[model samples]
Target: MVRQILPISALLLGSALLLFAGGMNVLILPMRGTFEGFSAASLGLLGSGWAVGYVLGCVFMARLVARVGHIRSFSVMAAFAAIAVLLSLLILTPWAWVPLRALSGFCFAGAAMIVESWLGERAEPQSRGRIFGIYTMVNLAASTAGQLVLTLGDTTGIVFFVLPAIFYCLALVPTAISSSASPRPLARVSLDLRALWRNSPVAVFAVFCIGISNGAFGTLSAVYANEVGLHLTAVALFASLPVLAGALSQVPIGLVSDRMDRRLVLVLVAVLALVADLAFIFLRPDGRLENLVMASVFGAAIYAMYPIIIAHANDHAAEGSAIQVSGGLLMVFGLGSIAGPMAAGYSMAAFGQTGLFVTSAVAHVLIILFGAIRMSMRAPVHEAEKAAFVTVPQGRMATPETHVLAASPEEAEEIIAAEEDRLAEEGTGPAHEAAAAATAAVAAATERPPRVSEEEP
Candidate 1:
């Protein structure tokens, strides 16, 4: 692991820089948009625009990496991200920034995927859990640091925009100079809705709902903080401190989830989120210290819910399908993310700062309802059969390399087939041989043909 770390340290450092930029931009952008006379609806549009590009990038950018390779793709995305930030600094118009923001999202997601892919490639199974945990910590810290960095700049000035560009440009340096071999080829992953629903309907639905709640709040939380009479520093802290807390809280939360029924843990988390949202809507705390505590509690509970949902889903996923399960849930979360901001943004537009909490509360209520519904039904999957839920680096943006684990169904079938073949070849059992042959036949029929049949028979 130490040897692995030495080679990829530069790559990881660059990833941290990229995460910092992503974090800083998230903190400042809506405020910047509002400063520039953009409406809440337009700001919501900007937020959703990023998710649109982000999810699209997650789906397709791996192919770009597969074609061009990781190093080249990383460079391309870094340059693109830096350019997008610069463009935003130059134009400073909602109309211009909207497309640039989308571009930025695309580049961020692409670069992050590259870094994670590198880490994943370097990691052994024995050390993967630790490596991913450290990666998540590093990223969470970077994002929090980025948000806090805004205290050094004037929110009303153009420096916030220029600063994130500087960080993004800085992000290009580490990976470009490192001589590590490019990561494995990128692959696409798709959710099998039927299997996922069969495994756990609540997990699937909860992931989507969690995505909506988190996405909406993530995009607009800082803006909402500002409207609620928090100063710039407090607003940044208000927005970031909770995520930091949430990341920290995951340890105990995960430990608890590991020991007991995950659904029960999820119910508690949803209830916590519901309480926080209600407080935000009604209590409207005044003291700075109190507000900090409130935000941290809210952040910890809401942000922490996704992992539980993921864990619960993995608890029942078919063997060797952890990647696909995570990917499908991620896609579902991304869809919810796009919806979250639109709903919260519109809510903010109609009802002001309080509306954000209202949107969040409603999401929590739905989640709670879903959890209840699932409790009535028997769990379809067991704890012993649970797939390992590995944590990727947080706020690192998804990239092609980072996403390779979640193979498309066809790809997964091929993988499952290959493993079966390897296992059968060494054993030499008639039953195993027959099973492999049958699986191969099924996979072959479903599998894409090696070559296109362009000529007519």
Candidate 2:
């Protein structure tokens, strides 16, 4: 394992530094904006702006990498991020920060993708899972540490902004100085909504709804923490703990999801999230401990939903197309992420801090209702048919490269063809029709010949 990781260590180091800066950059703005007397709506737009840039990056960053090469692209993104952070400090206004935040988002996405591309290239098939696991752990720890670092500094001054800028520059050092060769061009993602919906309505709907709920909380929770009069330490914990809890919760959730109908697990999780949302709205946890505990529960359910939804989608997806399916769902999630913050911001502006939970509750409720309806419509993909649930990091942090880390192309292709054939023998339904359409669409888009044998594996 040590030898396996040595080759990509610098790439991982770069990723860790990038995430640390990203984590701090994300937390600092809202906390500082609150102090700067920015409106809840404006802060919300900041989140929206980031999502917009992120979505754009997901679409276009590959082209940039293709044009400039990964090293140059990574360098450019890091420089842009550093500049964005510095400009935020200089201007100190919501309008300026919004665009700057967007720039930061675009840069962060590009940089992350580049590093992931490198990791993907270097990883051996046998050790890919271990590499991905370590990479995820490093990033999560770095990001958490970055967010918590704020407790040591004054948000009122330029220090917090400078810190992220410094870290952003630091992110460049490992990648820039590393001896590893650049990987192939980044994967291109096309979001075919009709096909995605046809593939699995439940996966599509749940992922989008999860995006809305998670986006709302992710952007506003810190602001919410501040409004509720929590101290800075509590506020930092409020933002970071849910992510930590969510990471830890994926183990049990993955085990359960792999065994039963993933839709059933999704419904259960959504209900739990809804319960947490209601608790926040009704009980209105004022104390730090009360809020912290609730956030952890809320995080566990919301964070775990994405991977389950992805796995569920893949279970229904045609062979050799899991990457495309995951990418499409991620794009759909990004679309929801862009809208979530804006809507949540308006709600918070109108309804106070509790509005955050109100927005989240509505999203989770929709997920539950829609998931149940889909459950009634389609038969569950049998336990043997299910794709293994790989743990994914939370929203926006996931990229196409991340999917490569989760499951190899060959592994994903082989997992379900046999079961799919069995299902076909049993009889065809809407699910079969949808899968066939999706398969055809993927074949056309990729310009690859469709696999002839359902039992090829």
Candidate 3:
């Protein structure tokens, strides 16, 4: 793995810089908007806007990458991200920041997809898993570092906004100037809700609800922290600790899911989330340490739910359809993410800081009720047939390209053909064919994709 990462360390640095900027921007916007006297309700719309733009990028950016090639596409996306960050400073209103935040989301998704495609080009089959593990670590650490860095200085100034813009430009340099080959056309997905529902109703419902809860807290924690009179450091920690806790807790949660019925694991996690919710509502702790502790539990349970749900769906998914299953669920998660913050924002308007968890508790209640109903009606997939669970690096911003980058060569070959047929119907052209075909050909011949048609100069 070390040897594999050595050649691609430059790209890893790019990932680090890009996500570091992203991490800063995600936290910066809400906190800054709050300082500027934006209401919790308006601030909450920022996350919704971002989710909307990200979903749009995931659905459409492949054609853009396919048209122009990776480097040019990446440069354009990075430039737009930097522009968006700077523009936020100029505009400085909730209404303006909301759409600018959306623009940043679109750019982040496209740029991140291009980076993952570059990494996918270089990963050897035997080393793919380890390389992506390193890549995921870089992304998570960089983003967390970016968020923590905010605690070091005042975020009310122009410098905070400039910081992310600087890193956004820096992020593109190492990869743009590298002597590496172009990767395949970026992966794309068309949402097939019926197919996803047929495969696993529990997975579909659980992920959407998880999206709501995760989105609510992820977006509004800093707002809640500010409202509660915590230090700036606590605010950053409030926003970040749950994500880190979620990432770590997934390991044991995944182990349990793989061994037993995954929905049972979902119920267990949701129950924990509920427990955290009740603690916050009733405990009403005014101390910083106490808030962090309960927030960590909330993070652990809520953050871990998506992967378990995805793994459960994979167990019921027909063979060779894992990518589509994940992609479809990703779309569902996006929609739920959009709704979560809006609901939490309104809840905050009515209920104060506690409204954030009220939104999430509602989501968890639905998941628990739905999981029970589904388990009652269906027998569990046998342990022998279950797909081994994998931790999704950043559940919030994971793109279709993330699955493409991480899957083993054999797993890549398992893509369902229905996606390709649908893309053809949209006229993305033959080069926009199945990611399976692209991955298979790349593995069999050259790892670099041969553009089947003329690409934009």
By TM-score, the best candidate is: 3
- Which should have the higher lDDT, number 1 or number 2? 2
Candidate 3 TM-score to native? 0.93
RMSD (Cα, Å) for all candidates, in order, is 7.7, 8.6, 3.5
- Tell me the spans in candidate 1 whose CA falls farther than 4 Å from its real position: 1-4, 380-382, 389-457
Model 1: ten consecutive residues of lowest lDDT: 448-457
lDDT of 1 at 402: 45
User: What number of backbone clashes does candidate 3 have, counting pairs of residues 3 or more apart or in separate chains?
Assistant: 0
Q: Write one digit per residue (lDDT tens) for candidate 2, span 200-234.
A: 99888888888888888889899999999999999
Per-model TM values vs. the true structure: 0.86, 0.90, 0.93
Question: For model 1, what is the alpha-carbon lDDT of residue 234?
Answer: 93
State the TM-score for model 2: 0.90
Per-residue CA lDDT of candidate 1, range 73-164, in tens? 88888888878877776787778877887887788777877777667655554455566666777788888899999888787787877788
List the candidates ranked by lDDT, beginning with the highest. Answer: 3, 2, 1
lDDT of the candidates, in the order given: 0.73, 0.84, 0.84
